[model samples]
Target: MNADGDETPEAAYRLLHERAVGQSPTPGERSLSAAQYDSARADYLAEKRIVAKPGVAIWPPTSQTLMKRLGNGSWSTAMTSLGLTTNSGRTRGTGSFSDDDYRSAVAEFLDAAADGDNRSVTSDSFAQYIVWAKERTAAGAKRPSGAAVRQHFGSWEAAKTAAQA
Candidate 1:
């Protein structure tokens, strides 16, 4: 079922077809493989019955729409419930922060901090860095926590040094 509780066989088939094609689904008419058709049918049935009760596991819980509903409007919670993991051992909302992302954030933070002729990376500076990182990151990208930053660099001074490099 779609957001309005309307049956959407075409949408389901499109999802399956796209998964098979390893690409985003395109609009208009398209053919479906036998397996895609069968999977779409199952998905349709699952969608229809998903909200009948609580705690029912939805197969292919990776669907963003379904996750939003299942998470009670929090996509992060839905991802957590689905056991999503990251290399940093942080869950969703804690930031999908990678080393490269951390480095870039640090660089930006250092630049902003140095604008006032303050080269030191103090606690307040680190806090500001978090805000800067959050604001500059792309939409849907996770926002790293202070802890994540510290973990990445071992200390504020180290992060500052790397950023200056």
Candidate 2:
């Protein structure tokens, strides 16, 4: 019951969720995963606009904002309460990559970082490359973080040595 006495935004948002997922959500339940939410949101935004009143169109908030608002001030907290998986897969850390994989990623990053210059791949540079790679590639294809690489080989220099070996 907003100013117009219509369904509240959260309610309408839930209805959109229902329509998108082909199932109604139980009370206080979040039925859409973050990915599904993003897809549904994109579709909703793509559809023709519906004016809520005079100049205002009914619209949903961005995924992070929506989760925060609904989940009581924290996006992760809200997501957890709704039983949604929050793993972005692109999150940086020591992953399950094998030693060989680490060597390959290090080689690739070193080559890319070197480019036409003779710049050496410091831990900082490698970390920056990992960030850049994560953005352009799928989550599974992203390079491990520099810290992970160092941890895998026990040191940055050792990691580079292994890659060159």
Candidate 3:
């Protein structure tokens, strides 16, 4: 539509759609909207936390009573709907980290890390794990079960080296 326009040559309107619709416009000119915007948001959210898919209706983590009730439900129902199931056939002990429980804990840790709250990792649930891991890696922790505490040369050496560094 300029002064030299020949019958107003077709001016294709280029719209920055994706950015306006809450999407990163760093990629293309194709306007992102409708399901695209939703998918992008869903993917981003899923990375930061658990996401119940379209067919899956995972309940928000709450009381242990509700979790136990759901665990006793139909396998398919829990797997497809609430996103859970029990592996009765497994030889795992009664005291074990369930898949969902592990995932939930990991999600919690990630959330805490994202929020920069290192103290948030002090969960009673993972307290045992912390103790176990610390003991396993603790210097001079290994003993014959009845043996007395001894100063480990390795730990002393490591401490001296770190101090010099």
TM-score of each: 0.34, 0.43, 0.18
1-165 in candidate 2: lDDT tens per residue?
A: 233455543654565577687875665554566557767766766674532366564565556656667666544455556554354444333367877888888788767666755344343365665664575356567667667777788987788789989
Residue 5 lDDT in model 1? Answer: 54
- Model 3 stretches with alpha carbons more than 4 Å out: 1-95, 119-165
Better of 1 and 3 by TM-score: 1
Clashing pairs in 3: none
Q: Which ranking of candidates, highest TM-score first? A: 2, 1, 3
Prediction RMSDs, each to the true structure: 12.6, 8.5, 22.0
User: Model 2 lDDT vs. the true structure?
Assistant: 0.62
| Candidate 3 lDDT over residue span 80-134, tens digit each | 2333232344342222444343334334333443454555344423343344334
Clashing pairs in 1: none
Best by lDDT: 2
Off by over 4 Å in 2: 1-9, 28-30, 50-58, 71-76, 80-142, 145-165
As a whole number from 0 to 100, the lDDT of residue 136 in candidate 3 is: 38
TM-score winner between 1 and 2, please give it: 2
